[model samples]
Target chain A: MNQYTAQQWRRYTIRVGIYVALLLMTAIFLIPVYVVIVTAFKNPAEINLASTWQLPTELYWQSFSEVMAEFGPRFGNSVQLVIGATILSSIMGSMNGYVLSKWEIPGHKFLFPLMLFGMFIPYQAILIPLFEFMRDIDLYGGIPGLILIHVVYGLPITTLIFRNFYVDIPDEMLEAAAIDGAGFWKLYTDIVFPLSIPGFVVVIIWQFTQIWNEFLFAVTMTSNDAQPITVGLAQLAGGEAVKWNLPMAGAIVAALPPLIVYIVLGRYFIRGLLAGSIKG
Target chain B: MKNNRDRSIAFLMLLPSLILLGIFVYFFIGRAIQSSMTDWGENPAQPPLSETVEISYVGLDNYVRLMTSFTESSFRVSLVNTFFFTIFFVAGCIMVGLFLAILLDQRVAGEGIFRTIFLFPMALSFVVTGTIWRWMLQPRGGVNILPTLIGLDPIDFAWVNSQETWFQFLWQDVPRILTFVGIGILLIMAVRYALNQRWRSMGFVAAAAIVGLLVFMAGAWDYIWPALDVPAAEPTIAPKGFNVALLGVIIAAVWQMSGYTMAMFIAGIRGVAEELREAARVDGASELGVYRYIILPQLNPIILSAMIILGHISLKIFDLVFAMAGPDNAKTIVPGILVYTKGFRANAFASASAVAVIMLFFVAIIIIPYLWTQLRSDDD
Candidate 1:
C-alpha cells in the first residue's frame, strides 16, 4: 500500500514537471514575437541602441504612420490577392472534387494524375519558364498574374482535400439530386457547396495564409507594380538606410492582417490543417 | 442524370487547374530536364550576334559539373548539406513537434494559450522572419540573453561558423563505449533477423529493442560528429566546416514548423473514432492497449501520409535555412539555393537554371514512389 502511494506521487510529480517544461518552451517560442511587438512601438533612436529583449523608455508610434503612408495599399493588394486566390482555387478545387466524386468523367483518371505531378515540381524549377509565359502574355506585372500562379500553385492540395472529403460522402445523395434533373449550377451552388462549407473555410484560411505570406512568386512574377506586401516590405527594409524600427513596423503591419484573419477564422485553420494533413 | 451533370460540372471546374498543372507543374518539369542538357551557361562571346547563343546538347554536363566542381566552397557545402540538412530538418520538426503535440494533447491547464503561442511563428513571412532570426542568431546579438539569465552558460555564436567543425567530417568518428555496445546489439539483431524462425516472445522483444536502438544511434551519431572535416578558419566570410550556425538555423525552422505539426496531429486525434474506444473497453483491454492497438491503427494512414508530405516538404525546405543562415553560407542546399545564387545573383543564369533542373529531377526520384503508393492505396 505504501509503495503504491509512493508510485502515485512520483507519477504526479513527473507529469507536473513535463507540463512546466512544455510551458517554458512555449514561452521561448513567443519571445521573438514579443520582441517584434515591443520594437514596433519603439523609436528609431531607441531601437538602434536598446536591447531587442528590453522595452523602450517610452511607447513610440512615429514609424506606424511612416509605414502606413509607404505600404498601406500594398497591404490591401496582398489581402485582395489572398482572398481572390483562396476563393477561386477552393471553388475550383471543390467543384473538381465534387464532379470526380459524383460522375465518371472521361480522362479524369489520367488528367488527375498529370495534375498531381504539379505538386512535385518545386517553385524554383518553373520560375524562368513561368516568367517567360507570364511575360509572353503580358500578365507578369499585375495582380492577375499573381492570382493565376497562386490559384495554380494551390490547386493540387485543395483538389485533393475536396476529393477526399467528397469520396467520404454517399454517392446516392448526389444521384438523388441528379434524378431530380438538377443542373451543375443548382447542384454546386445549393447542395455541394453548402455541405462543404467547413472544408471550404479551412481551405480559404489556409490559402489566404499561403498567398499572404508568399515571397518568392510575388518577387519573381511581379516587379514593382503589383508586388505583394511580402516582397514590397522586404525590399523596403533592404535599403542602405534600413532601420530596425521601420522594418519591424512594416513586419508588424504585414503580420496583423493575416493574424487578425487567422484569429477570427482561427477554428477553421485547425480544421484545414487536419484535412490538409490527411495522411498517416 | 444528376451524376451526369455533376460530372460535367466537375470536369469544367477542374479544367483551369488542369491547365495550371500542364503549364506550371508538368511542362516546367520537362523544361527543367531539357535545360540541364542545353549549354545555357556563359559561352564564349562570338561576333555577328549568334541567335541561338550556342545551346549545346551536353548530356549530363551539368550533373558532372555539380559533382566535380570544387571551385565554390559554399556551393559544395550546400550540395552535401542537402541530405544532412533534410535529415536534421525532418528529425527536428518531428521530434519538437511530437513533443509539443503530446504536451498540448494532455489535459493540462492553459493548453489553448500554449498552442497559440507555439503557432505564432507561422504568421510571420520568411523574409522578415529570416532577417530577424539572422540577427537573433548573430553571435553578437542578444538572442542568447534568456539563457544567460538562467546561469547555465550561454552559447557563443562565433564558434558556430568557426573551423573546428570542418576537418572532422572527412574522417571516421571516434567510437565511444555506448556506440560499441549499440553496435554489438545491432550485430546480434542482424543475426536474429537473418535467421527468422519461431522464437520465444522474449526473443521477439529483444530483436525489437535492437532495431529501436539502431534508430536511436543513427540520430545520436549524426549529432555527435561532424559530417565533414573542419578546416582552420579564414578571415573571409566563407563557410568553415559543417558550420554550427546550421544547427541554430534549423532550430528556427523547427520553431516555425512545429505548430503545423501540432495542429495536424490534433486534427488526426479528433478524427479517431470514439466507437473504437467503447469496443476496446468491451473487449476488456487496458486503456494503454486500446491506444496502442485501436487508436494507432486508425492513425497509421494519417501518420504515414503526413510523413510522406513532410518528408518531401523538408527536402524542398529553403525559406528557413535562408532565414537562419542568410543567402550566402548557412542555408546552402544542393539544388534549390545553389541555382538561385548561380543563376540570378551570380549572373550565371544558365548554370542556375541547370541547377534548378537537377533539383527537380532529384525531387522526382523522391516523389514518384510516394505518388505511386498514394494513388495505388487510394485505388485499393
Candidate 2:
C-alpha cells in the first residue's frame, strides 16, 4: 500500500511538472496574439493610457469600424482573390500531380524536378523582369495579375502535395476504374476527383494562407486601388504617427480568414504539412 | 496506339504547368540573366523606354564589381548577415522544435490546445509578426515593460535599432574559420558513424577532412577578400559581425517555425511503436536515454527534412526583414533585400541578377540533394 502511494505521488508530480511547462509555453506563444487582440479592441485614447499587457476598460468598436470603413472593399477583393487563386491553383496542381504520378510521357521524369525547383526560386530574383513582363502582358496592377502570380507560384507545393497523396492510393483502384471503360477526364471525374476532397482541403488551406498573407508580390505588383489587405494594413500602419489601435484592428481583420480556416480545419492543415515535409 | 494515346493525354495534362512555369519561372530567369549581362537599367534617370537610352553589354563587370569591389559595401554586409542569420535561425528552430515535440509527445493534458496555439503562427503573415514584434520589443513597450508590473525597472532594449555587435572579426578570416568549423563537425559525425560501425560512411567523412585540410593550406581563399576601392572611410580589413538587433527577428521567425518542426517530430515520434520505447524502459533505460539513444536515431530523416525546409525559408526571408526593419536598415539587410534595392532603387539590373544568381546557388545547394535523394528513394 505504501509503495502504491509512492508511485501515485510520482505520477502526480510528473503531471504537475508537465502542466507548468505547457502553461508557460502556451503563454509565451499567446502573448503576441493577446497584445494584438487587446490593442485592437481598445480606443485610441485608451491605448495611450493603458499598458500593452492590460485589457481594455471596455471593448470599443471604433478601431474596427474605422478599419472596416477604410479597407472594407479591399477586404472583399482579398476574399475574391484568395478564393479564385485557391480553386484555380488547386485544380491545376491536381491535374499536374495526377499525371505526374499515374501517367508519364517521354520527358516527364525531367519535367517533374524542373517544376518542383520553381518552389525554391526566390521571387525577389525575378522581381524586376517579372514586373516588366507583367506590365507588358497587361496584368500588372490588378486582381487578375495577382491571381495569376499566386496560381503560378502555388503550383510547386500544391503539385507536390497532390502527387505525394495520389502516389499512396492503390493502383488496383485505378485499374478497376479503367476496366469500367473510363477515359482520362472520365477517370478523374469519377474516381480521382470525387476522392480528392482531402487533397482539396490541404491544397486550399495551403494556398489560402499563402495568397492571403503574401506581401512582396502583392506590394510590388498592385497599386493603391488594387492592393491586398497585407499592403493595405501596412499602409494603415505606415503613417507618420502610428495609431496602434487602428492598425491592430486592421491586422486582425486581415488575419481573420486564415485564422478561422486553421482553427476549423486544423487537422487537414497538419496533414498537409506532414505530407509536404516528411514525404519530401 | 493506346499507349501513345495515353502518353499524349498525359503530356496534354502537363502542358499547363509546363507552359506557365516555362514563361514565368524559366523564361523570366533567362531574361534576368540576359538583363544582368547588360547596363540596360543602370542609368536611373533614363528609363529603358526613353528615346536616348543606350542599353549596352557590360560583360562580367557587374559580377566582378559586386564581388571584388568594396565601393559597394552593402552587398558584402548583406551576405555576411545572411550567413549568421541562417546558422542561428536554423539551429534555434530545430532545437526548440525538437524540445517541444518531445515534451508534447509525453501525452500532456490540453495537447490539442497547446498544439493549436503553437502552430497558428505559421498561418499568420510576416507583416503581422513584424508589426507586433516591433511594438513588443520597443524600448518602453510590451516585452520590455512586462517587468514593471512586478515593481522592477523596465528593461530598455533597442531591439530593432541597436548597433551593437558580437564576435566582431575581419571578413577575410571567414573562409579559414569556416573550414575549421566544417572539418570539426565532420570529425564529430565521423566519430559517431565509426562508433555505430558504419565504416564506409566514416571513411567518406575522413576523406573530406583531408580535402578540407589541403584546401586550407592552398591559400585559395586569399583571392576572396573584397577589393579596397577607397582607403579612408571605414575599417581597413572589412569587418563582419552579427548584429544584436536581429535577435527580435530571429525570435519572431523561430516562434513561427518551431511549431512546424514540432509537428513533424511528433509525427515521427508517433510512428515509432510504443512497444519499442516501453521495451527500452523495461531494459532499465532512463527516459532521457530512451530519447537520446532510441528515439533520436529514428527521427534522423525528419530532422534533416526540417532543416532543409528551414534553410530554404531562411534564404528567401524578405517580407519579415522589410516589414520589421524597412529596406534601409544596414544591420538587418539580407540578400533578398539586396536584390530589390539593387534592381529597383539603384537601377542596377545586372547587380540584382547577380545577387539573384547567388541566392539561387544557396537554394540549389540545399534542394538539389534533397530532390536527388527523394527520387532515388522512390525507385526502391
Candidate 3:
C-alpha cells in the first residue's frame, strides 16, 4: 500500500509538470494571436509601442472597418484563386494518383518520383522562368495565371497524397472493375472518384490554405487589379507610416477563413500533411 | 498481349501530369540553367530590352562575378545568414517538437486544446506571423516589456539591427573551416569504425583523410588552370558571425513550424506500441531511459523526415524574412530574397539563376538520397 501510494504520488507530480509545461508552450504559441487580437480591437491612438500588450479599455471597430475596406475585394481574389486551384488540382491529382498507384505502366514508378520532385523544388528557383512563361502565355497579371500556377505546382503534393491513399486500397477492387469491362473513364468515375471523397477533402483543404496564404507567387505573378489578400496585407503593413491597428485588423481578417478551416477541418489538414510532404 | 492496351491507357492517364511537370519543372530548370550561363540582362551597352531580349553566352562570368566581386557582399552575407538560420531554425524546431510530442504522449488533459493551439499558427500565412512577430520583437513593444512587468529592466537587446556578430572570421578562411570540418567528420567515422570494427572501411577512410589533408596543406591547386591573370583585388569584406537579426526570423519560423514537427512526432509516439514501453519498464528502465533508448530508436524515421522537411524549408526561407524585415534589410538576408532582388529588382538575371541553382543543389543534397531510398523500398 505504501509503495503504491508513492507511485501514485510520482505520477501525479509528473502529470502536473506536463500540464504546466504544455500550458506555458501554448501560451507562448498564442502570444502573437493574443497581441493581434488586442491590437486589432484597440483604437489607432491606443496602438503604440507603450500600449502594445495592453487590453483595450473601450471597443474600437474603426480598424476592422478600414482594413475590411482595403481587403474586402482582394479577399475575393484569394477565394477564387483557392477554389479554382483546389478543384482543378484535386481532380488532376486523383487521376494521376489512380494511374500511378493502380494502373501501372512502363516506367510509371520512375516517372512518379520525377514528377513528385516538383513538390520539393523551391519556388524561388522557378520564379523567374515561371513569370516569363506566364507572360509569354498571356496569363500574367490575372487571377487565372495565379490559379494555373497553383494548380500545376500543387499537383505533386495532391498526387502524392492521393497516391499514398490509394496504395492501401486492395488490388482486388481495381481488378474487379477491370474484369467487368469498365473502361478507364468509367472505372475512375464509377469507383475511384466515388471513393476519393476523403482524399478530395484533404487535398482541397491543403490547397485552399496554401494558395490562399501564398504570397510570393501572388506578388510576382499578379499586379494591381488582381493582387491577392496576402500581397494587399503586406502593402498595408508596408505603408510609409506604420499603421499597426489597420494591419493587425487586416491580419486577423486575412487569417479568419483558414483559421476557421484549421479549427473545423483540422483533422483532414493533418491527414493531408502526414500523407503528403513529410512521408518517408 | 491484352496487357498492352491497359498499359497504354495507363501511360495516357499519366500524360497530363507528365507534360505539365515536364514543361514547368524540367523545361524551366533547363531554361534557368541556360539563362545562368548567358548574359541576358547585364548588358549596359544595350538599350533596355523587352520580351524578346537577346542573351549572349557569358561562359560562367555571372557565377564568377557573384563568387569574386566585392560589390556583391550582400549576396555573400545572405549565404552566411541562411546557413546560420537553417542551423538554429531546424534545431529549435526539432527540440521543441520532441519536447511537445513527449508531453502530449503522456496523455495529459486537454490534448485536443493543446494540439489545436500548437497547430493553428501553421494555418496563418508567413506574412501574418511576420507581422505579429515583428510587432512583438519591437524595441519597446511586446516581448521586451514582459521582463519589466516582472521587476527586470526592459531587455534592450538590439535584435534585428545588431551589427555585432559572435564568431567573426574572414572569407578567405573558408578552406581552413572546411579542413577542420573534414577532420571532425573523419574523427566521427573513426569512432564509428571502432564501434563497428570494420577495418577495411576504416583503412579506406584513413587513406581519404590523408589525401584530404594533403590537399588542404597544398593551399592552392591548379589542376585545371584558366590561364587568366589573377585579379589584383579580392573580396574585401571580412566575414562576421551569424547575424543576431536572424534570431528574430528563426524564432518566428520555429514558432510556425515546431507544431508541425510536434504533430509528426506525436503521431510517431502513438504508433509506438504500448507493450514495448511496458516491457522496458518491467526490465527496470526509467521513463526517461525508455524514451531515450527504446522509443527514440524506433522514431528514427520520423526524426529524419522532420529534419529533411525543416532543413529544406529553412534553406528556401523568404516570405518570413521579406515580411518581417523589408527587402534591403542586410542583417537578415537569405538566398531566396537575393534571387528576387537580383532578378526582379536589379535585372541581374544570370547571377540570380546561378543562386537559384545553388539553392536547388542544397535542397537536392538533402532530399534526393532520402527519396531514392523511399522509392526503392516501395518497389519491394
Residues A1-280, candidate 3: write the lDDT tens digits: 9999999999889878988999899889888888999999998888888788799989899888888888888999998898898999998898899888887677877888898899888888888888789988999999999999998999999989989888888878877877888767777788878888998899989988988898889888898889999998888887447979888898999899898999999999899767654363
How displaced is residue B215 in candidate 2, in Å?
4.6
- What's the DockQ for every one of the candidates? 0.50, 0.64, 0.68
Query: Whose TM-score is greatest here?
Result: 3
Better of 1 and 3 by DockQ: 3
- TM-score to true structure, per model: 0.83, 0.94, 0.96
Please tell me which predicted candidate would have the highest lDDT against the true structure: 3
Order the candidates by TM-score, highest first — what do you get?
3, 2, 1
Q: How does residue B59 of candidate 3 score in lDDT?
A: 85
Ranking by lDDT: 3, 2, 1
Model 1 chain A — which ten-residue stretch has the worst lDDT?
Answer: A271-280
For residues B163-209, what per-residue lDDT tens digits would candidate 2 score against the true structure? 77778866555677898999999999999999999999999999999
Task: Provide C-alpha RMSD values for all models, in order.
Answer: 6.6, 2.6, 2.3
Clashes of each: 19, 0, 0
lDDT (tens digit, per residue) of candidate 1 on A119-148: 556788887677667877888778988998
List model 3 lDDT by residue over B228-327, tens digit each. Answer: 1223333234254688888888999999999899999998888889999999999999999999999999988888888888899899998898888878
